[model samples]
Target: MSRWLLCLILVLGLTGCQSSAATNPKLPYAAWYLGFLAPNYMEVWLERADISDINGLIFPRAMGGVVAMGQPESLSATARGWPKRIGSGKGRSMTGLDLPYVVSLRWQSMVEPQTYHAAFLIPDWARRKMVESLPADCPVSGRTSDYRKDLTIGLAPGGVVKVWIMGPCLDPIEVLTLQAEIEPKGPYGGKSGGKYRPLSPVVKAYVDKYGVPYGSWWAPIPYTTVGP
Candidate 1:
């Protein structure tokens, strides 16, 4: 079957499969839940450093790769982590480590998959939001969790990528926005469907439920910031 046809099949068969498994409530740190919104089929790999102060947090690349597509958004699996304590006894404090986070993605065009890669740096605003002070009643040895647990990625034609991050204690914050070096490749020599490709079933469903927030078509979404 054609790639588009296979994607359509996944849309029909994988309906209601967007939700990821729930993270444990008692965990004291951020557990990442990844979500993706796109009009085309994509293979995604997430990479992060092994040494992090956020204990138990794992990268999706370690779990192989993620297959994502559709609209509204589809979530893959969850990565759990907790805050690691520093020192000992009354002097113990939470250690928040800053590590590199990277993403490699492949989108299947008409003839082949066009690959793109980008790295995410936790912005200052997000870093501040992650490290709120502990409450007075909390033990002196205990500390607040310092991590954003949710990440969403929006993909458009021509390699436009928009990324957002949030957590239970924070609101959604856009961290990365850029147009990648994606070679031109699509239906009709890339002329017929620059941003007018018909809505796939998954996208149509999202429109039916939430309406289109991007004016008309979703692709070529306006860029808020252009660089890293």
Candidate 2:
């Protein structure tokens, strides 16, 4: 090939490589919504998977944690303002998967303390979908076409927990479920302090429509998102 023709080919090859590198799959991102369903507030926290329990930091602290306010409302104004775009590539779980973070929940009962714990993992397939969801940034295109992601966690009475990945472009994915435990009534049931608060309206509506169901830890949740 002529000198100028060869240089042109090399330049084009470099451009293609750069494009591929820029688009390589990255850690997925999503907003995290957390809520508890008991009569009194619950304390919740997230920690790096490998962090020593003796030294790991917890989000929001105990007094300012993600409280058990009720079921998180996705369409409400509060939804948009929840913590967003948490980046994760942390420790590994026992199964050799990429363990991003561990979720810890604690609450009190009339006679004893209760707890629920779980971890979030990322799989190969989710990484691919995250890459595909990347949107173009043209001044005219705007962000309307962008794919939004949300990871919602709900903890009910008796340590029952449910997690789901929800977004406009994809159907909701139920990632984790923890079975309910039979326990003494907490403050909510007027068993302890004689103070009572009903479950949040959203949670109550769901219970009214469909009674609480039993479940168990079936699968590790895939971490699409968590708090900052």
Candidate 3:
């Protein structure tokens, strides 16, 4: 063999060799996520697989959440104000294979405590506890009654991650990842937020029909343009 051919042979021998196993290419599994919705806020609140202690994050006794499934594409579509068939509305549930992967959705939106007219209905003890958690200058609490905030947390193999909710107001589409604590403590449950009461008749209908979990009754968006 020529000097060039001998050098080529040596180079090939030093490196492991591999080739395509089949003529047809196989597609990878698409990354579909459990699209957790933040009730009336109409946003992709977060995404995750079921981890223990997640209930507190989703169904905090003080607030509620709803669940759905989506692709990265779907979340992008939602930000543009044109959510596809999967986006949910008040009293509606969107079902798909991903339904089983969802942990849950929080029921309260930043506006819920205020919009539900829940201030007067809160038990005195719960109200007092909320007041004590804030600064003396920040006397009021409950939903975003006098303030607005968004929280973000993430999880990885060895640890959890977070993007502290900054700003008094956040975009509805802001995404966060957080640790799951088997359950949430008494944090959110605006009056009629459904922490203690039966699901609204309309919310129950969706649950019964789809067998999907939902938090509160005030979905402000429709699942489809034609309506669900």
Candidate 4:
């Protein structure tokens, strides 16, 4: 190989090394090291909210994989973390989540384990059957709106079908519903023919023992920090 060509390659290699350092530049000491080790290890605050218009939260995947939360504006500076979260594939089971018959995911992203708020989204219409299923403390109050959405799906189902909440994550009671009819045709796509599954184990046991705040999608949960 030519000496000049070899020299050029060495210079480029050194520059690339320097550029890599700036990728995660200026991060907090802990966030840097921990995030460097495992981005999923990062944990931040999910501020409290009052989701008058929202009704449920679902995590299709957790741990170090992709995570989708909130809506288009949910990630914006002023957006309430209560977004219509969409996950890439079915996730592992939590105490309350059921993993099958899920569909029409809007967006999907991975978690970085830094302090960040995970938003919740309310189904546009509440299911009369699910009305009793909502948290006991959940107030049955709000103007009704049409349940509406569009999307694609898989030909074969995998993982938990429905994910229920077990914490104070916010959602709208009015928007809650047992999703509509589904007709899976083939892999890589399908339409939302009004299909959804019933969520279980929504609120933590503490709330069941002692009542807590009523959150809504029409409203934002109050700004309170939850710790690492």
lDDT of each: 0.36, 0.34, 0.24, 0.22
Q: Write the per-residue lDDT of candidate 4 for residues 130-184, one digit (tens) a residue.
A: 2223333323544232211111111101111122222122332222222212223
Candidate 3, position 93, lDDT = 18
After TM-score superposition, the amount by which residue 141's alpha carbon in candidate 4 deviates from its true location, in angstroms, is 41
RMSD of each: 15.8, 17.6, 23.8, 22.0
**Candidate 1 or 3, higher TM-score?**
1
Could you give candidate 3's per-residue lDDT for residues 28-92 as a string of tens digits? 21211222233212222221122111111111121224333222422222222223222321121
The lDDT of model 4 is 0.22
Ranked by TM-score, the better of candidates 3 and 4 is 3
Instruction: Output the worst ten-in-a-row residue range by lDDT, candidate 2.
Output: 46-55
Q: Model 3: which ten-residue window has the lowest total lDDT?
A: 113-122
lDDT ranking, high to low: 1, 2, 3, 4
Model 3 earns a TM-score of: 0.21
TM-score versus the correct structure, for each prediction: 0.38, 0.35, 0.21, 0.17
RMSD of model 4 against the true structure: 22.0
Q: Residue 67 lDDT in model 2?
A: 42
Off by over 4 Å in 4: 1-22, 30-194, 201-215, 220-228
Model 4 residue 194 distance off true place after TM-score fit, in angstroms: 4.7
